[model samples]
Target chain A: MGELEKIREARKKWQEKYEKSCTERDALFQSISGVPVKPLYTPEDAEGLDYLRDLGLPGEYPFTRGVRQNMYRGRLWTMRLFSGLGTAMDSNRRYHFLLDHGTTGLSVAFHMPTIMGVDSDNPRARGEVGRCGVAIDSLEDMEVLFDGIPLEKVSTSMTINAPAAILLALYIGVAEKQGVGPDKITGTIQNDILKEYIAQKSWIFPPEPSMRIITDILAFCSEHVPRWNTISISGYHIREAGSTAAQELAFTLADGLAYVEAGVKAGLDVDAFAPRLSFFFDAHLDFFEEIAKFRAARRIWAREMKERFKAKKTESLLLRFHTQTAGCSLTAQQPENNIVRTAFEALSGVLGGTQSLHTNSMDETLALPSEKAAQIALRTQQIIAFESGAADTIDPLAGSYYVESLTDRLEKQAYEYFERIEKLGGVVKAIERGFFQKEISDAAYRYQKEIEQKKRIIVGVNDYVVENEKVEIPVLVIDPEVERIQVARVKALREKRDNDAVKRRLEELKKAAAGSENLMAPILEASRAYATLGEIVDVLKSVFGEFKEIPVF
Target chain B: MERKVRVLVGKPGLDGHDRGAKVVASALRDAGMEVIYTGLHQTPEMIVEAAVQEDVDVVGLSILSGAHMALFPRVLELLKEKGVDDVLVTGGGIIPESDMEKLGKLGVGKLFGPGAPTGEIADYIREWFKSSSRAKG
Candidate 1:
């Protein structure tokens, strides 16, 4: 008999003997995303996987292994912890602390007022100023945010959308003040507006204008800020919003394709902007499945870019991503248990060949990470990078039969989703028709039911049976004084700055926004005049109306 | 026939973490209650007005932005000012146990935290509805 047939016969004989001798657990064996998990995988499972065709060498065409040739052997993945809270000064102190503790990059989280494009003094901003993140209303806040930290040295990732342009302009303005030009600054903006409409629900304008703004950013960044990652097409929020792994993979790639199409239609070269594009994904539970999802993501993206968009540059075809341990996986019952969950998820990201990572703190489910908890989270990554030996090799899980099989399955599932989305017109139309929203809601509800029905086990919740558990971890508390201080600072800036210059710049911005002009220049001009985020957003909102979602449950 | 338990699920403030809210809403619907979901970005005034207009017996406010302390009291005060005393205000988010107790002391119903079972929320509402004067009437 042939080797393959011999293995298949042996596997069948073993399964029959095993089944007769020992009964398996009386439960459905499946992945977190509902994919069936078989007992044993062998060479038969990887029957037709063409290693050379499907997964070439690291950094080669169809980069299913790793994006870089040497991978972490050349340089370790960046430990960029997402941190921001209270005022700019407060967050700045935390940044210095992180830097002192060996953090490689900076990630900023803006408060809701700043994120929603509202000034601290706006009535809508009441009770929310500096609550979730640092409140930056003008260039002044940005400057203070990077007070002693040099912009040229550390690459910053700002978690802001809808008002992403204004925030980017403010960062540029600050860089100029530090005598650093746009070319000298390097970082990424989560300028992914599509996911905002789909999951995050923090959208400012409708789809048409939002895409326009994104394309403008793409165009300008390709010319001026070549080192900057113009857009981090994100699947983090989609997964966080209760999407299945396949849905997150499919929808995120779909969004990336839509952005590529938008850029091409805007008359920009795909190779120019596509190379600068990046991705963000959530490293959730389901250890091997998460690894498979990452591997599949790279292969699918490279194939799509090469075949569909005709991307010529090798860089344009490469899929570089930042992974964050899933925040939704954290539990509040026994908070310390979250540390272990985050560590495992972080390990998955490492083995999946992530370029950057952010491990969630143990106290995050209750509040913003306290100082001690943030340190522990950072230490978790350090341990993985140095101690766990995960980063010692590239794509270490590449040829495993189960992993290879799962990767193929996920890639097939993602392509199927892409076809369904195409049939429904496109991503924006699908979003408008509530297709993505309904699918995610159903998945989320199903997962919840699984937990309630004892089908899935989440330790410390629903199963471990810890009654009268007292959470002893210290949670971060945002002082009420921070809001007062932020509101007063924005008010004082309004009084101190040149109001006429601000008005003139805003009017110029409105005119540029009305015309088909690249908005970065005018927005930077407004930022130079210390225009508040609310003012800049108001001007854009006048030209481009706000988006109201068709609420779906 | 007994009147269906009417619940107005309100997402107040600016944060967009609505997975919990939507799950609870669907669970309530599955539990055979009348659920009116006021989508995203509803202020306190808007939520109260919807409750009064819909004549909802319970108003469940989901605030994850840490603005619950400021928002919950505002909704309760507005409901009282509008002379809607029969309505119950309860919801869940990333609220701490201490804060939940404080809100409870402020006359709000029992608040839940993360990882809470939807069935428990439904049971809480049903039990409250049974004891509430609306059920006796």
Candidate 2:
């Protein structure tokens, strides 16, 4: 008999025997995304295997297996623990400490006030200044935040959304002050405003203007900051908001497609800005499933960029991504167990060939990670990079029948979602109708229900109950003094800065906002004048108006 | 006709972490209560104004930015000044034990922590409602 016929006969015989002999926990089994999981997989599971077309070589067309040809052998993935807390000066200390501890890249975590586009002294910003991250009020604080750090050397990623333009201006302003050219500075801005409306809820401007701002940044960054990644289209927050892996993949890629479409409509070449496009995914505890999701993400992005968007450049076709260990998966009870959970998640990111990664600290479920927990989180990445031989090979699980099946299935589901979204008139319209939000919320409710009923085990949470579990881990406390110090500094900045220059720049910004002109240059000019983040944001808000969310549930 | 239990879920201050708050709001809505969620970056005053306008029987403030010390007391004070004393002011989010005690002393209701179940939160609000003046005929 032919090999194919023999395999078919064996599979049929096995199925017949397994139907009667197989003992199972329940009737059905599936991954977190509800893709069915099989007991044992043979050649039948990996039915359609066109080696080159399905998953090209690591760096070849489609770039499915890995982004680069050499992968980790070329260089280890950047270990960037998203660290920032207290004042700019305080966070600067933490940055230096992290750098000294061998973090490959720097990621600034803006305080809640800063992220919301509010000054430290704003009444709404009271008590929140520098609580969650560094308080960046103006260019002065930005300079202090990067005091000794050279912008030309280290690749920094800023986790900012709604006011991404303002933050980018600040970064460029600081780089200029350091005598570094725009081309010399390399980094990424999480300029994904779509997810804000969909999940995170940190949105400022309404959607149309927000897309306008994104396209404007894309244009400006393409021309000026050639080396900078204009946007990090993020699924991290989507998954954190409780999206299924497929939903996270689909929604995020859909957002990327929408952004590319907007840029094209804005009269920019797709290849020019597409090469700078990057993705951010969440590495959850579903180890192999997360790996499959990552692989699927690469294949999908490569095919869609080359096919749908017709992106010509091979660089534009490459799907580079950063993975962050899931924060939502962290539990407060027996928080120490979070360390192990994070290590596993980080391994998934590394094995899945992430370009950069952020491993969450154990105590993050309670507060911002303490210094020790932050180090452990950083060490988690380092150990994966050096000790664990997981990264020694590219796409280690490439040929696994189960993994390939999961990847193929996830790819199919993602396409199905793309069709559904297209039917809804694209992402923005879908978002307006709360389609993405509804999907995430439904998934979230199901996941929560599963845990509540013990259908899912969350270690210390749903199963292996630990009563009176003392959380002895050290928690980082943002001192009341941090707020006091930050408030006074901003109040003083308002007094010392060139008020007339700030006013003129802000007025110019308002004019630019009112018009169809790109606002990046005007905002950069405002940053040069040392206008506070709140001032620039308010000037734009005066014209663009704030977004009021249509609650999904 | 029975009056529905009205809850205003407020995210006071600048914290944008509202996953827990949204989950709880959904839970309350699922539990047959009227839930009005004050979206992110709400000032304590704004939350109180929302509470007064919405005529909510309960105000659940969610603050994760470690600003509860300044925000919670302000919300409580604003509720009192608005002569809305009968309304319950409770909250959760990274609030250490000591602050929860202080907040409790300041007349805030039960403060749920990280692992606190949504069902228990719903029950607490329901129990408070049963004994509340609104529940009395």
- Worst 10 contiguous positions by lDDT, candidate 2 chain B: B13-22
Instruction: Name the top TM-score candidate.
Output: 1
Lowest lDDT block of 10, candidate 1 chain A? A22-31
Best by lDDT: 1
For residues B1-137, write the lDDT of model 2, one tens digit per residue. 66899999988877667777878888899989999988777778788888899888999988887888889889888888888878888878888777889989999899988777788899999999999997763
Q: Lowest summed lDDT over 10 consecutive residues: which window, candidate 2 chain A?
A: A26-35
Regions more than 4 Å wrong, model 1: none
Candidates' chain B TM-scores in the order shown = 0.98, 0.96
lDDT of 2 at B94: 86
Binned by DockQ into CAPRI classes (incorrect, acceptable, medium, high), candidate 1 is: high
Fnat measured on candidate 2: 0.57
lDDT score, candidate 1: 0.93
lDDT by residue (tens digit), candidate 1, B40-137: 98889999999999999999989889889889999999999999899899999988888899999999998989999999999999999999998977
